[model samples]
Target: MSIQNSIETKVKEGFLALYNTEIPTVEFQATRKEFEGDITVVVFPLLRYKKGNPVQIGEDLGKYIVENVTEITNYNVVKGFLNLVIDDSFYTNFFNAIYSDATYGFVSPKADEKAVMVEYSSPNTNKPLHLGHVRNNLLGYSVAEIIKAAGKKVYKTQIINDRGIHICKSMLAWEKFAPNGSDGQKETPENTGLKGDKLVGNYYVKFDQEYKKEIAQLIAEGKTEDEAKKEAPLFVEAQQMLLKWEAGDAEVVALWKEMNSWVYKGFEVTYKSMGVDFDTLYYESNTYLLGKDVVAQGLEKGVFYKKEDGSVWCDLTEDGLDEKIVLRSDGTAVYMTQDIGTAIQRVKDYADVGGMVYTVGNEQDYHFQVLFLILKKLGFDWAKQLHHLSYGMVDLPSGKMKSREGTVVDADDLMDEMTATAKEISEELGKLDGYSDKEKNELYETIGLGALKYFILKVDPKKRILFDPKSSVDFQGNTGPFIQYTYARIQSIIRKADFDYSQPLTIELHEKEKELLKQLELYPETVQQAAANYSPAIIANYTYDLVKEFNSFYQNVHILGEQDLNKKVFRVQLSKKVAETIKSAFLLLGIQVPERM
Candidate 1:
């Protein structure tokens, strides 16, 4: 249990025993930045019982609670709140207990005793991943990590949208413009392989322009409008191609096989660069047909009915939702169809599985809400286990990122900019020493990727964030690089010392050190709360606070080469311990720290 919770529990027990009414929910307010108290508790909730003068009431209750609770060494009433100071022994015990045990502050013995599945980064293959996808990837990755650390068994997966009309647009453009341009395997003399997604994407844009022009030109020829459209060759060809591909036409399949492999390779490279991972990858080409059998069974079970237009419909108006399309009129499955199938398949495949969580965007909230409700109607009793971890869209300083507007921030480009910025700053400061080209590249990636992940994870999951290329990604003031710098400083401290652990140590616990240790004690509680609520931002915020405190201590206290050698040894050990704690915290938040930054 966390110290805050322990304190809350103690306060609640005392209040409940004294007041006799059902104990009010106890809340331990976080220590204010400028405050000297360990924690502040608002006594306003009990004001009515103490005859309404809030300040006096707070005073009386503060006295009674402090007198009764031995943990409260000293406490006072300020305004209508009780400012309680805990004993240093609590700080000593808490810090020792906290920093000693691992889990980096995550709580154990998870409630509900069930399983969870998290699906994130469901990227379409028609384009390379961009900044929006980066947000999705980091949120999904960190949230899954958070949940797992909280003691739940989490399954992380992704759905690859490889087969669709949009993808066909890219293929069409490629066929018309780049007939023999792509070997897909060819790295040019410059050693640049045409990136699969980009190579494919440019053609998609080309197809749109050329197809529109052709349609307009044919319309100007005074042919009947419907006739002009009907004579469009690309659509006819693309449709025929899709049919052929679906029918196992050997040549078309081979082309698709080769093209998709290249795209996946490009995607893999990007995923590696960004440090995202997946336990499983579900392909639309393979899983698109997945729900047909289940949807059929659902129809038989009266979960769905045939529409007048011969499409399959699930009537949800009884539950205040409109009737939804299940299967297309042409017997083809749409997005919802594939999802229904995937849900059923997952259950059957992992029969002992506890639940599934989709880390999709907020736009898909209606889809999953409807999906889960439909599963319930289909008599899947375990369907209630489904969850949707909906996240908001990421906007830039200009506006919302739009691909057509050319405002989309490509993931590769963003990382490159960040890496270059880190390198530029490092070089200007003359910080890196004797680094080879490879080492410099790797260092840039570590810091650069850390910057990106930290930027995305710092914001609350529900609120949309506006990214300022300058201020938002800066290294100082609650950023990942700041934490990395603290880690490196600690490493430097450790490297300069060969201290004796066998000697008996007495902790003087100076003001800054005590406050820092107190904050360190809060780590486990922070992790538990963050993991429990699926918020990595909490961990991010805590990590920044820890480093900030460490920096304060670093500036004031001398750890190495202290006049008192024994004190130097103790501070060195403390520095080592802080480094260890920060590294673990960074890992939990899905950021990595370079040994030197």
Candidate 2:
């Protein structure tokens, strides 16, 4: 058991013996720095059960603990707080126990545990991913890794928004504006040497431009703004195209498949570059009409009602939400309908999936709320397990991004920019003196990506981010490269040790060494807390704290240079463990560390 748990058990025993009163729990916090103790037990909460001076009560408990708890060597009472100083041997034993564990803080999933499906990077095929998508992917991937480390099985998945008016807009624009006819002569990713998604996305922008021109011309011909917008020739043609695509017209389907294939290839390159992946992919083209059958079942069960216009909706006003439409008036499935069907289809495919996490933007918070509620109302037992990982917008310094306007910070471009920044900064610092050009470039990529991922992941997910690329790549402060550099320093120490430093030893602990060990002890608990909160920020900050502690120890204490062989070996061991913990924490955040940076 943890020291805190043991203390709680003993504290309850003390309460029963002293005042003949039963206390169910105890509250403890890290002792303040000014206080001469390692842990503090708050005596304020016990006043309700045992009516007396809190200071006296704390003194009595401290005496009881020092007498009964062997690990606690000494104690002091400050007001209502009882502070206990633990023996150094306890920390030494704890360090020894975890020293050889390569995966010390991770727990493996048990056989009976149900799997969690984490859906992230659910991007549209019309455009490449951008900065906002970067945050989503990082957050989702990190959360999934953390959950796995906390002993739960996890499956990464995404739903591709491959079919919609937005996609058709791109296709229509490409067909009308490409240099040649819509055949082999058309502008392809190969001939143009442009990414497939970018090429397709350019056309999406072109469609908007042309559509706007048509709308203006119609308005000039004495039509109202709304009338012109609806009556524009381009708009009508796009609607017709959608209808034909839904009917599975061979020619339209062929074109859609070809263009979407280009987009899929483009997305593969970007996802690879960003270091994110999914175990399964659900396409809207296949799942768009899915929830129609479910809607019919809901109608029979009186969970939904059909209006005179033939639109289907679930009445949720009684449950404090407005009625939500599941199907259109023409019997076509809406987005909500498709979402319900897709969620159910996932369970059918993966029987052991007990819950799903939707890593979507906060704009759709209400949508998820309704979706989960409707599922529960429809009698899905697993609906209660659903969660919406709602996150705020990520903006660049200039401002927000608009995909159709092509003003967004493209994911590929952002990553390339980070790499270039790292290269510049590393060269300026002259840290890569002996490295070959190839090795230097690879290290730059690692540092660059690490900075980008760490800067974004270290913030609370719900908080908006104003990302500055240059600021994120800094070599100092609470940044990814900073922590990574510390790890590299420890690696250098390991390499420079000429003699064996692996033997177990007992030595007097320096204050810095003790502080570092205290920080290391929190790693497992940090991982568990990060998983429970579904927040990568917790792990990211914990790693920063550990790095800070190790740096302090490194600066103030001697490792290999120490004359005492036992002290030198123990310090080396402590440094190695700290480096291992940093690597493990960074792994959960999807950040990489360089051995020499």
lDDT of candidate 1 over 1-597, digit per residue (tens): 555666667666655565654455665675575665778877677644433666765565567667766767777677766777777666556555544555655546455666677888888877788888888888888888878777777778898988866677666666567644244633321234567766655666676677667778788988777876667777667778788878888987776776677678888888888888998778888888978887789889999999878899999998988899989999988889889998888777766567787888888889988999999999887787777877888888666665533457888888888888877766777777788888888887787778778877988887787765445445678777777878988887776676674343556567777778877777767777887667888988888888888888888988776788766765776676678888887787678887865
Clashes of 1: 3
Tens-digit per-residue lDDT, 155-201, candidate 2: 99999998888988999999899875345588999878889998998
- TM-score of each model, in listed order: 0.89, 0.97
Those runs of model 1 whose alpha carbons end farther than 4 Å from true positions after fitting are: 31-36, 47-69, 107-113, 179-192, 222-231, 300-302, 397-408, 434-436, 469-473, 501-506, 561-570
Q: TM-score winner among the candidates?
A: 2
Q: How big is the positional error of residue 546 in model 2, measured in Å on the Cα after superposition?
A: 0.4
TM-score of 2: 0.97
